[model samples]
Target: MTFGGLPTRWEPTGESRGVALVAPGRAYSPAAPLLEFSRRALLQHGFTVQQLWWDSTTRGEDEEPEQWVRRHVEAAHAEEEADHVLVVGKSLGTRAASYAAERGLDAIWLTPLLVDPVLAEGIAANAGRQLLVGGLVDELWDSAIARELSDNGCDVLEIADADHSMGTDDAVRTAEIHLEVARAVEAFLSQI
Candidate 1:
């Protein structure tokens, strides 16, 4: 099934023991820069990446982000039952990940949009089994929500001294942040 938008490229390696679905942020495509970074990072951790683009009706014609994700996830499951699906999302994509969690899918949230109570409930529901990464400085997630997530069982990892992007404008700093994200995901995926 096409799931509306562009289908994500699945790079398979013999070492890959599981499948990961990369959900894009907002109206963005699965191949967007941030998603690509996460995809490569997952590959490093030995997961075959399935980049799923959310066709956002809110952002464009006939592109409802929520519907797109649900469809993609169902399609993914039909194609191959993932040992665990690591749902990585940006701003809007974060919301989509939460929905996936409610359906009992394992996830890895990057800079999740915690303002939404639904998202929190999803994270709380999947706590230690899934890793939740957020910036120390992202206003999108408030302290109370953070506490709730931790209280509910989410493994909250704060990116210290970083903003929403988790890195300064310097190339070296960005790479460092990416590497850090990669390591965290790899460690978490390894444990699962």
Candidate 2:
């Protein structure tokens, strides 16, 4: 499907309780493990998932990275008719945090760039519930900032020894980490 002139993959459930707008990281497509499992979790919870794809090559010369991300996310969100909306983003995709905050939408941010002042402030300003997941080894993640956001009422999951991809050297442990994230997502969905 196409939303806001961008190619998107829409998965509709029989009886959806809400709509999940999934924004992928620059390198991480919707098919990536973290996003793919998260989409599955949303589907299990009765949400119609609309997964967006970004083409950086199409970005305008004068547009900043954050502006480009916000443009696409806003476009997709504008097309949603559901009252309950959830924004699930990762890495570059997490740039949409401000949009979610302004719209008072719930969100799940995976490996968010906690270093970006604008994004950090946006997450802190979110009016609805939020779940923030990040690996301790990720350079973009700041433990202090994550804790601060947690204190502001956002649920946080910090994985030990995991990298930006939420993976460790051991394949078994990486798989377990993935499962753990999925379970966390499920639990969060249950609450809100």
Candidate 3:
């Protein structure tokens, strides 16, 4: 159902240790298996999940996803009583890095567009705990920036031969990578 103009899916675990705000990519769905796996992992770790799914086709060129994320996150955080807030963003969703940083919220950026000068600034300016996960094969993935972030204490996960979606042509390896991704996210959440 929609929450405050945002197409939101909120899964509340009876007793929560924290809240996880999930943001999908421009073309990605919140129901994607990787995100679903993250939800399950979060739930298992005593966290509630709030997923925001957006349709890029309907958005105008002037539309800024960072604004959507900032608005919704502020509203959601106000409504939630959870002590810890964690933001999980994928691809386009990573544009909210600056906003998330401004709010002092920890974030996990999946396949972040680090090559974009505008987006890279967000990551650079962010002081919050940031976890960056990307594949070496993805053209937009900037290892240099990721290395810098890693050196500065951001958690980094680099999957070999994986594409933008962290997927490989080999089904078996893809499945293994998916599990690895889920486990890494889980590990990151535990620290926050």
Candidate 4:
């Protein structure tokens, strides 16, 4: 299908609980491990998931990232189930945090850019049930903001010795963190 003139892949289930928009970080496609995990988890929870293909080639240097993302999300939401949208954004895609806040949608932010004041504030202001997972060592990951978001009822997972890629020296530990994130997403979806 097409969304906002960009390509899209729709994975809809028969008995969906809601809609889930899997926003991929610029580095990867919706098939990226992080986004794939989120899509699978949402599918397991009976959500109709739409994986958007963000056309980086069309992005203008002077364009506002928030508006760019919001336009696409809004376009997709118009056709599918959207009463309970779960916006899952990672890395650069985290710029869409404010879009979620504006729409009052639940979200799962992986390695979100807490360094961006506007993005961070959007994550904080969004009243939807949110799962914010970031590594303590990642430059973009701010422990203080994570703590604040946690204090404000957002489920925050601060991984020690991990970096922006959710990786550490130990491969086993990294795998465990990955599982933990998926489980947290499942739990959050259940609650939502």
Candidate 5:
């Protein structure tokens, strides 16, 4: 499926209170465990979800990576009619942080690339409530940065021993981690 010239999967809920624009990572799709559960949580909270799909192949020849991502995110956002908007992004999808900040839209960034100055700055600039989920073991995640953002009032959830996928090598523990994240997402939505 495609919306606003980009591949998309839309799930509309009854009497939706808002819209959640889900931006997937470089490899993770909306159907992945983390994003899928997050999507379900959003639906349970009365949000209509629109998941954007893209990859390196989707980028134009002359376009910068960040610009490509922002363009797609903004285009999807423009198509929404809801006054309330929430952006749910994972890893590379966190590139939408700046766009969300500019719009003052609420957001949930999973495994955000905190090492990138631009991305970190964008997350900091967001005026709306934001939840940042990252693992201590993930190279892209910086504990100091997350703490700094938390100090600035953004909600932060740092899972120890979990990797970039927010999972450990132990299957059972990984599943439990997923449950923990799902619960966190639910709690965050409740506050919003």
Candidate 6:
């Protein structure tokens, strides 16, 4: 799929009933290793997957990341005829996905960015379920963020001893995070 003069990173998968759309973190490319893990995790649980790379470099200076995400989502859903779209985003990408969900797309946001009001408004607007993967022990996140999300009706899933990335650079923790996401996806898909 394509958006705003930039080429989107989309992969066709064999699974039916669900499709995953992942947005990479800031300064991260579409080819980042995390995408592979996300793809495999979803595929393992029977979901077709697609990735959309949304970074500062890909959007216009005044453009909202959520708007960009929505465009990509519309194109992907139309082209692929996907039954449901699960949005897996990291950092700023999370912000974008949450906002897109608010705009009335059926999605499950993974590790969504909860800091920005613009993004938060969209998330609140969505009225859809969310999955939080942040570490409970990390200093970066406190109870307030979690409370705010829950207050806004997001279903928070805290990962103990994980960081903002939800995994150590080590292989074992990375695998664990991937597994957690897979389980969350399964649960979310089952509900819908």
Clashing pairs in 2: none
Better of 2 and 5 by lDDT: 2
Q: Candidate 1, 182: how far from true, in Å?
A: 1.7
What does the lDDT read for residue 41 in candidate 2?
A: 90
What is candidate 5's CA lDDT for residue 100? Answer: 93
Superposed by TM-score, candidate 6 places the C-alpha of residue 78 at a distance from the truth, in angstroms, of: 4.3
The number of residue pairs in model 3 that clash at the backbone is: 0
Model 6 weakest 10-residue run by lDDT: 6-15
Q: Summarize candidate 6's per-residue lDDT along 81-151 as a digit string, tens digits.
A: 66566777666566655445654554555455555666655666775556655666555444576777777
Deviating ranges (above 4 Å) for candidate 5: 1-13
> What is the Cα-based lDDT of residue 75 in candidate 5?
94
Candidate 6 wrong stretches, greater than 4 Å: 1-15, 29-34, 136-142, 151-153, 169-178
Better by lDDT, candidate 3 or 1: 3
Candidate 4 lowest-lDDT run of ten = 3-12
The Cα local distance difference test for each model comes to 0.67, 0.91, 0.80, 0.82, 0.90, 0.62
93-168: candidate 5 lDDT, tens digit per residue: 9998999999999999999999998999999999999999999999999999999999998999999988999999
Q: Put the candidates in TM-score order, highest first.
A: 2, 5, 4, 3, 1, 6
lDDT of each residue in 28-55, candidate 4, tens digit only: 6777767778888888888888887777
Q: Decide which is better by lDDT, 1 or 4.
A: 4
State residue 22's C-alpha deviation in candidate 6, in Å: 1.9
Candidate 6 lDDT score relative to the true structure:
0.62
TM-score each candidate. 0.75, 0.94, 0.87, 0.89, 0.93, 0.69
Model 3 over residues 1-192: C-alpha lDDT tens digits? 674575455555577878888877877777776788887877888878888766666655776766765665567667778788878888887877877777778888889998987777777777788889999999989999889889887899998788998899999998988888898988987787
RMSD of 4: 2.8
Which residues of candidate 1, in runs, are more than 4 Å off?
Answer: 1-7, 27-29, 32-34, 55-68
The C-alpha RMSD in Å for every predicted model, in order, reads 3.8, 2.5, 2.9, 2.8, 2.5, 4.4
Runs with alpha carbons beyond 4 Å of true place in candidate 3: 2-14, 68-81
